[model samples]
Target: MKKLAVVNGKIIDVEKGSILQKNLFIEDGKIVEVSEKEPDNSWEILDASDCYVAPGIFDMHVHLRDPGYEYKEDINTGLRAAVEGGVTRVAAMPNTNPVNDNISVTEYMIEKAEALFLAELYPIAAITMGQKGETLTEMGLLAEAGAVGFSDDGLPVENAEVMRRALEYASLFDKPIIAHEEDKNLSGDGVINEGRISTLMGLPGIPSTAEEAMIARDVLLAGYTGGKLHICHVSTKGSVEIIRWAKKRGIPVTAEAAIHHLTLTEEDLYKAGYNTNFKMNPPLRTEEDIDALYKGLADGTIDAIVTDHAPHSKSDKEVEFDKAPFGIIGLQTLLPLSLRLWKENILTLPELFKKLAYNPARILNIPGGSIKVGEPAYITVFNMEKYTFTEGMILSKSKNSPFIGWKLEGKKKFIIVKDKVL
Candidate 1:
């Protein structure tokens, strides 16, 4: 590959926890040099003036819905949306038509994604076969087939014995078992969060206990079996408390908070007139929960910020509030919404990037989150400014975001993956 220079940008290195105004020189898809003075006329220069250049964003949780619900999202469109949001890598969930429990399904997704070549995709195979929480999948075989981790994301592994066995098995391979952390009995037929909003709206509620109880069980299991346990979309204060306690005891546990959970509260549902777009699993929590989540992120209890980029067709989300499916398309809004953390003084710029880029990569044990010399040239440039988000700007096949017309801060200007500018 030809040498390329990204110049005149404030480079933020999360690994170093430092930000500096410097130029990066890339050659053969890897960063070869960083300098204060630009190289001679031999290099192709990409101007990044008035913007922040950081490691390419890595979203550890996203549902591509390929090989099954392509109408809602496919590999091509979903990856394109990831580029628009400054994400160069993502971990696709396994809850598809034929769940990614076997090696053939995992190989299919790997080949299809390699053909697209827009972003690096890591497949997270299912923990339980068919996601029924009954039998465990072939964990060793799936991992050997390039699965970065294991998770039955859309559905929590409900049986404690099954979960314990799955974690013990996954530990042999040093892979994390990402838990969805919900008790079906506790969440019984509940559509929204169980709190004041659910009461006022006259809708069934999913209490915070539903999520906390499951997290508590999983934490203990991780401690008992020495398994790496990762909590997905942690949305409750009590859940944070349990994970924090587990970490204090030196248990191998890590957790992630979704962008929506950190930014929106249950009150947003009432303000938006009960828009179905705001609904999601582990639904938009209370303000206290949001505060705890932000605090968790600030203190490193929450290891990363994930999109949980669940997409649905308009037909799926346009019905009555209770009838609508749970989830919202979030790929395009991840950067803008996460920028709110820095804007609100919850985390500094470098600290925020640590959660967005380095932390997730470290948890998944994947490449492409550093801007150091000899690292692959995966980078994102964004201008922190005021802009309005609109449905027309959405690049995903599904336009199910709640931030459609909202004015937001920060916008990505360029996305470069493996030396190819997108």
Candidate 2:
């Protein structure tokens, strides 16, 4: 086993909320020690001064677009993008062409990722077969084949009876049924959040109620079935309040606030007479909603900060605003944008680390989301400084970014894991 030591770093103790000056020694891909003193001259040393050493980010929501749709994104490029952005592990959504609803597809994704020796990538299988929401997937076997969780992603199962049974069956495996909470009926043909912006922009509106209605139903189903429920890309304040209350009532519910939702608003979509690049689903809400998103993160109403990093081909995004695909490539920009929160004094460095890494690991039952000694040596070294973001430089195959020229703060220096630099 190779041994390497990172020297002179400000380590973020997420569990303790303290920053310690320390050096970390890694052996056999695990952290053997973290000490205030430097290692004796035998091991390879990586400089970490002026960097905040913390656990690598674990993004619970992302679309690698492999198995099919390689033009949009593939396993290798997606993983490389993730590692480059300081994410060591990710749970890739299974809303691909074949959909990860069966054991063969699930195994294929897991095997494909392992063969590449890329970042730690786990697949979240589709909750319903083919993601049609008509028939349920083989949850038990899917979990056995290494599906970390289950989600239909872009399509929410609108039938309450189907969701209830899925929850009951999925609970037997102790895996979370990650729901994309949206009432399709209420959403209709809406492209962005239903509000004054939608009306002014002459676009159909997807009211916040579309999201809340589903979450409200899922919370009760999860409560009734005793299943763990995870709500993805929670953009509305009403949903955050529901999740907070559900947790208080002993419901096994967890929710994530996307990076964009915490930073941008629907007003950015008001670039007059322009084609849309700023549009995204759970469409960016008002500034008031952004504040609520931050509040959710601070008060523990939101359990994690997910990139919701959806990638689409340029041609797919070139169409009209209402017709174009709804998403953005956030994997590479998640940390820096989120760091804007830290630089602004909205959250301490340690607090941000908790939301980005530790807390998600706990809820997902993953072991790599910590900077603790003796754990797997998955860490991100980052620089907290002013910088500008650009699109073509993104490591992903797609270049669809809403924040393409944003002046952002903080950037990742390295993604360290498996006794090697990724």
- Deviation (Å) of 408 in candidate 2: 1.8
Write model 2 residue lDDT over 1-422, tens digit each, in one string: 68888888888888888899898888889988888776777888888889888888888899999888999999999999998788988899998879888999888888888887767888999988889898999899999999888888889997888899888888888889999999999999998889988889888999999999899999999998898999999999899888888989999999998898988888887763334567788888998888778888888889888888888988998887777888888988899988888877878888898889887777777687677777888888888767777776798998888888888767788778777776
TM per candidate comes to 0.98, 0.97
Show where candidate 2 strays beyond 4 Å.
Answer: 272-274
Model 2: what TM-score?
0.97
**lDDT scores for all predictions?**
0.91, 0.86
TM-score of 1: 0.98
Minimum summed lDDT over a 10-residue window in model 1 is located at: 361-370
Candidate 1 lDDT score relative to the true structure: 0.91
Candidate 1 wrongly placed segments (more than 4 Å): none
Q: State the displacement of the C-alpha of residue 186, model 2, in Å, after optimal TM-score superposition.
A: 0.2
Encode model 1's per-residue lDDT on 1-422: one tens digit a residue. 58889999999988778899999999978999888987789988899999999998999999999979999999999999999899988999999999999999899998999898798788999999999999989999999999989998978998899999999999888889998999999999999999899989888999999999999999999999999999999999999999999999999999999999988898998788779999999999999999899889989999999899998999999999889999998988899899889988999888888888888888887766888999888888999878899999999999999888899888889888886888
